[model samples]
Target: MAKTTSDLIVERLIDWGVDTIFGLPGDGVDGFFEALRTHQDKLRFVQVRHEEAAAFAAVGYAKYTGRIGVCVATSGPGGIHLLNGLYDAKCDLQPVLAITGHTFHDLIGMSYQQDVDLDKVFMDVAVFNERLMGPAHAENLVDMAIRAAYGRRGVAHITIPKDMQEWKVSDEQRSKANVPMHSADLAAPLAFRPATALLEQAAEIINKGSKVTVFVGRGALHAREEVEQLAELVGGPVVKALLGKGVLPDQSPYTTGGIGLLGTAPSVDAMNECDTLIMIGTSFPYMEFLPKPGQAKCVQIELDPTRVGLRHPVDVALTGDSKTILQALLPMLKKKDGKFLKKAQERMKDWNELLTDRGTRTDMPMKPQVVTHTLSRLLNDDAIVSADSGTIATWTARYVQMRGNMQFSLSGMLATMANGLPYSIGAAAAYPGRQVVCVVGDGGLSMLMAEIATLVKYNLNVTVIVVKNNVLGQIKWEQIVLEGNPEFGVELHPIDFAKVAEACGARGFTLERAEDAEAVLREALAHPGPSVVQAVVDPNEPPMPGKVTTDQALHFAKALLRGQKDASKIIKTLAEDQIREVV
Candidate 1:
């Protein structure tokens, strides 16, 4: 007897190790839903309110578990909604399979309700895109999509027509269509031998120079030890990008932290002062902050050839796996004396002291840096942290130091808001026993507040901390810096986030004082189920140790002078506070 195509698809998914799928059902996918109902015990389907949230949830699951996250949506509008979250998954390099339902094959170009070219729409965001042309091709297509997503570490899309849902095939034929496991291909020839030679030459230049620095990127993820060894070999300090956080231990003597708009002081200083700069595994976009090509010899090692010399001109460009390339250079590199290393270490010490002092301040209404530091100290060493975009992300990036066992997940490339709660839900679902914390700003939390229902439905024991400042704080700071005006559209009417949490059947608390933060956080962390702690912070407080150019400072000053005639003295005091904190 023949089996339905939906059953064959489910069988293939099982073979691919997908036991659960996060999605919402519609008329177009009703037949597929029925297939799921038959295999209810073997394959669980999580129903979500919106397709976007479903996709976001899959990202969290993929990051935590290192598996291909699967989500389903109906054709057209539902599929369109999945694009934003799928893009987030794609950029973060998470493996996701987005399966959507389509109209009958004969209805092509007929303008049926919800008819759209899903494969074309999702092409840019997904690594692989295809519609299952017929029942015979379903098994092979599903298998290929899964492999592409897994191997490439990106999103993949598969569109299933409604007519193909109930089509049948023999049981033996279905069993033969099982997805095959792919082995990691480590034997491929390294791409950049000539580039590697240039890197060696760059190393010689570094040894000859007084100040050398390494700016690490996401490309160096697997080669942390090699990169650290390289830094030590040449007496250079390592500065990471936001996506490259925690690649090496934060406390490593050679590590100088990240450099960007939301960067630390020592990192910015190291990059600026270096005589030779080595770019590893990063296609960093901010060319203005990079060392001028002539001032510092810039050498870049990347996997993609197009990325080489695309941003800042590279004096040397090596295209290969960071591990393979760095390993090759290790034998050729000579041990350098410690003068440069010592200077970099001293700068790092000063930076660490500055961060410690600012975090210990008692006068501020709620020092965000202090709160993040305290949370890092209080949480379990193995805990997972998911931070939303905006000021909260900036604070977390600077303050949340990750230990070996701890995992930090964020929407890095997409930089999307409202990712924290759903990400936490997905992470908790992926690792039910591990402690998961969702760090969100007031504005981001308000956008997808309904996902709190998902947490409640799953009874996920994730702790959510909302930084409540009654404004879109990051953009407000930008307005203060650039436009020299008090922010107009950034202010938000206050919402009782704790009460909302309670309404969603999760425990909730409101923290008004900084002193109460630690205890409240500890309590929430200890809760048996999902909880929300709304931390009301000062709106006017400035982010610590922020970098401002001379021109930016002038703009800020002009804005302050134009707006507050009598408050010029107060503005000057605030600006002085930022400067003092740096030293």
Candidate 2:
């Protein structure tokens, strides 16, 4: 039998080290499914309840493994449903390939069922977007698409016509399985080197400033050792963007976790106090948290030249691999004599004491901090956590202590809801036998409750800890800051999520009080199969910002003028002994 495009693509994927795929089968993709069936022994296809879940799984797979993730969907609606998850990949800068099916080329313009303008739909989201218009160069096209995604560190998309799925390739092309280089293996030795003059320019700026604060982001994930060395050489404390949290272990002497709304007070202080800001491999938005233009001498190091000075105008912009750029600039730097890093260290010590005290409180309507801290204690050294957006993320950011070898991921730039469950599913699927935990709020969990069944079907060991605040807690806080709009629609009617999990054929549990938290979570953690532990947390506890400017203080006064009753609860939570000393 002659080789089909599906067979050809699958063979190439095999060579690229893709042993699994996530998607649901549809009529438009019958041929591809048939090809997958033939390759079942080599590549396992994990069927998801929704197409979006498949995309989320792909993104999670890439995030966990540092490799290109592949997901497929049928034409039209099936393809459209993938955009949210694909967008998550794009925003987080994960490399993923999305293959969407189309109707027979003959039927493309005739409005056949499920016929979408797949090219147009995916163009904006993908770095490389194309439709497979012919069979002659189909294999090369697959190679190009996958390479583009992995090289550009963004999404790559391809549209396939149903009729060509079984088309025969040339004898030479169909000879035998010859997989191309795996994306990960190829990327390891690849790096761009900056010019010598730029390194000297950056070093000069760095050496002149006495108080330097280093900012790192996702791009520095693979350069942990180099980043730490750079921090030591510059006599600066390191602050991470939210997605960059685990880049430097919290135990590192100069590390101050994350900075901004979900960040620690020490990190906030570092940004405000530093005279020189050395941003390495990060394009963190939230300019309000940074020193004003000209307030600090800035040096930005990024591989992509276009993004070198994007966040703030820099005195020196060095473009190259983060590890490479820092390596060149390391020897030229002299350690500063200032005490900025020490002062920030002191602040971090105080902040740590404050969070630990708050996280262990036995207050009724258990604080969410307690839930996160407890979970952190229970996590195995190799555990992977998939946190969702909103107040729960803030708790995870501050309260969860990540010490070593553990990975933490969340929807960073997109900040979308309902990604926790799907991301956990993906992480578990990719790394069998490893514990994957999803920390999400009630608002996020309820949005994609159906995917719980996917967990049971695969028997993936994922523990989902739903922090039940029974309100859109983050949005409610935002409303309060936006001049007390009387909280029009932030309330969430509490659902017994454990019961929902039990219905889906998974173990269900609850933690309503602080006393039961450890025991209940331990039980869930030990469960052999998927489980949901719904812990009721205090909704009124404020998700405190690291710093509150005078304008924000004035806005809070306006919020009080509009008579926000919920504000009283937040204040009461803040005044509790656990927070009083810190706030």
Candidate 3:
């Protein structure tokens, strides 16, 4: 049988080393689906309930494996649905490829059904965007798209018209004089390193400082050992951006967990006190959490020269991969007195003790912290975890200790809602043998409840821990603390997510009492297939910052005065939480 454009595109994807593709099938993509069916042995198609989830899953897979994740969809709405997830990949700089089917070529400008000019729609999000014109264009388009995604570390998009998918690919097409040939072989990643002179200059700035700090991010994950050595040599705490949570175990002597709003007290202190700031592969946007300008001499190490010194002004900039740059810079760093690091460790110890106290309370309406703290203890050493954006993120950041080979990620800069389940699905697909868990809040999980069915269908082992506090907890607090307004339109009518899970053919557990959190979490985690643990928690509890500013306290008080809902209960919980540390 003669090959078609769809066949050639699929073959090219296989050649580029893509084993999995996530998407939903539609009539516009029927020919492509047929091609996928014919090539089933070489490619695994993960059908998602929503096209959005499919794109999110691709981003998740790319994030976990450092490979070019691929997703597919039909025309118009399906193509539009992919924008959010593709934007997430673009913002985070993850490599991903999105293929969407368009209307028949003749019907494109005739306002045919599902014709939406996807090329223009995807222009802002994709690093490379192209369309398949005929059989001759398939291989070259796919090759160039994948290359662009990898080279730019962003999204690449291709729109195949319904009619084009059926075009024949034969020897005659290849023999055409106008046809251009291209190679589909996968290329090695560029190994970037900074010069010795730049490393020496960074070291000089570090050597002069008495109190230095290493601020790391996801870019530093590959150079854990080097980051640790740099922290030790500089005699300062190692603070991580949220995406960099697992780079060093929380228990490391040189580490202070995460920075910014969802961060520890010790990290805030490190940033405030440090005289020299070494930013390694982290473009953390929270300028308020960092040292004020001129308080510290900054040295930035970034692989993308365009992003170097983007967040903070740098005394020296080293453009290279973190592992190689740190390796070259480490030897030049002079050892400093252990005093600075020891003080930060003492502060971190105190902070950890406080977190333990907050997380162990045995209140009837379970504290959200207990859920994360218990899950942290029950997780396998090699587990992969994903979190949703909400107060649940605050709890996960504070309580979940990343150790061993455990991996963790969330919607870092995008901070989108309802990504937890899809991210776990992607992680499980990428590494089938490893345990995967998704930690999310009630509101976030409800946004994509249908994905639970996807897990059951695939028989993917994923434990979803839902902190069921019937409110949009994060925004509620933000209104009170940041805006000084009474919470409005934040209440969520309760749904028994456990029952919902059971209805979808997955095991479900509920935790109404704090005492049962650990036991329930253990069972859910040990379940052989998909499981859900709906933990009823106290909504009055706020995601308190490590340090509360006067304005925040005033705003919180003002909101209460303006008749915030459940004002008395909120005050009691807030007071009790704050009083625990001092007493």
Candidate 4:
């Protein structure tokens, strides 16, 4: 017997262990939805306002759960909307499968309404992209897409022709499910060990260096204990990439927070000052922040062989998983002199004091640091905090300490805004028991504020804390430092986000002053349904580097000379040790 191609898709997805699909209804996808309606218990559909949100939610699910995320959308404009979120997943190297409907095969070349070539549109973003040829290609294509996504650690896509979706699959196609694909088949390339000869060369280089620092990335999240042990053995401090921020507990003596511009003083100090830099599982770009070429030796352990030596010229490139390589190397080395570690420790201590003072200041307008630091205290051990890129990421990166079983995720390489709400929705949907919190700025929240309705519809336990600074804080500061120009197009009118949340059928709170922080946050977090807390943060607050560049100071002077507004305010922002804690 033969079954509809739509039923074949649904069944194959179930075999892939996917329980949920985020999407919107469309005429082209009616057959797929019909199949979904029939398989109510096994397959779930999450209806969202925009196709973009569906894609972002899938990205969040993949990132937070380490499972292949699935999302669906219909043809033409609906499929077009999914590109941005799919690009985010591609950039972050998360595994995702996007199933979209297309114009009927008969209408595709006829220039019929809503007929677009989805295959060509998704070519650059997807590692594997194609359309179903017939019912016979359904299971094979879907399996290949899923496998390709997990293997390459990127997005894979499929577009089903609206008419072909109704075609039947033969009984011969059904028997293929007997040899179901196992989860073990999706293991990341890092699971296997490198050659013994490669390991030996890496160990030799690591043991010879007296002043070394271990840098971790998202790949090291599962290997934190091994990373900490290796750091202890080398007498080195560990700096993190933004994606790897919560790998080592914040309180760890051997760990320093994230690197690059959004970094801590200790991480900056260690990277610039180390004689040997051991980069594990991260290909952190922005070479200026790293040790200059010929200044220090390097060793990188990356699962992808092509990515190794791509950033820095490597002395040893061990192509394997972070945990496997680190565990192997840990036994071969003796502890080095702690002189470099001591200097970093002292820097970290001083940095902590400055950060604490920054977060504790009781100013009229609540500082962004206070927003994150307060949340740090309110967070339960098992919370998943998703931060929007921009100024909010600065506060979350350096100020909040994600300890215990808590996890923190942000738009790292993509640096996109508006993902916070969708990410929280996906995270909460994936882990129904754990609490999900999103820290988003006014500009970011406004990008996808409508998604609040999605949260309310799901009745998820999500708390969105909006930082209302009324400015594009990160880009504004960058203009001053990078171009020596006063802020242009950075100012924004303040918005009462609490009101927006209320309109969407969720609990809302407004904390205008610093004193009301504790009470409002408590109320918002305790809300059973989706809640939003709007805090009016200080506009003068700035995030600078650990050591201010001469270019930065000269640029500031030039901006002031150019008759920039609030010169005095700019001076205060620069001088307030509380404001530029990272710098």
86-160 per-residue lDDT for model 4 (tens digits): 999999999999989998887787988779889999999999999988777777788889889998999999999
Report the number of the highest-TM-score candidate.
3
For lDDT, candidate 1 versus 4, the one ahead is: 4
Q: Considering lDDT, which of the candidate structures 1 and 3 is the better prediction for this target?
A: 3
Q: Which stretches of candidate 3 lie over 4 Å from their true place?
A: 171-181, 579-583
lDDT of 3 by residue, 1-583 (tens): 9998999999989988899999999987888999999999999999999998998999899989989899999989999999988998998899999999999988998988988889989999999998878888788889889999998889999999998898887732554554465455565576777777878888899999999999999999998999889888888999999999988998999898898889988999999999999998888888899989899999998878899777888899998788988888888989999788999999988999999998899986788998898888888889999999999999998899999999999898889998888999999999999999999999999988999999999999999999998999999999999999999999999999999999999999999898888888888988999999999999988888888787888888889899998998887887788633311
Global local distance difference test of model 2: 0.85
Clashes of each: 0, 1, 0, 3
Model 2 C-alpha RMSD to native: 3.2
Q: What is the TM-score of each candidate against the true structure?
A: 0.90, 0.94, 0.98, 0.95
lDDT per residue, candidate 1, 118-201, as tens digits? 988897999999987655667777888888887677899998888778776543243344443332212224345445557678
Sliding window of 10 residues with minimal summed lDDT for model 4: 181-190
Clashing pairs in 3: none
Sort order, TM-score high to low: 3, 4, 2, 1
Judged by lDDT against the true structure, how good is candidate 3? Answer: 0.90
lDDT against the true structure, per candidate, is 0.79, 0.85, 0.90, 0.85
Global fold similarity of model 3 (TM-score): 0.98
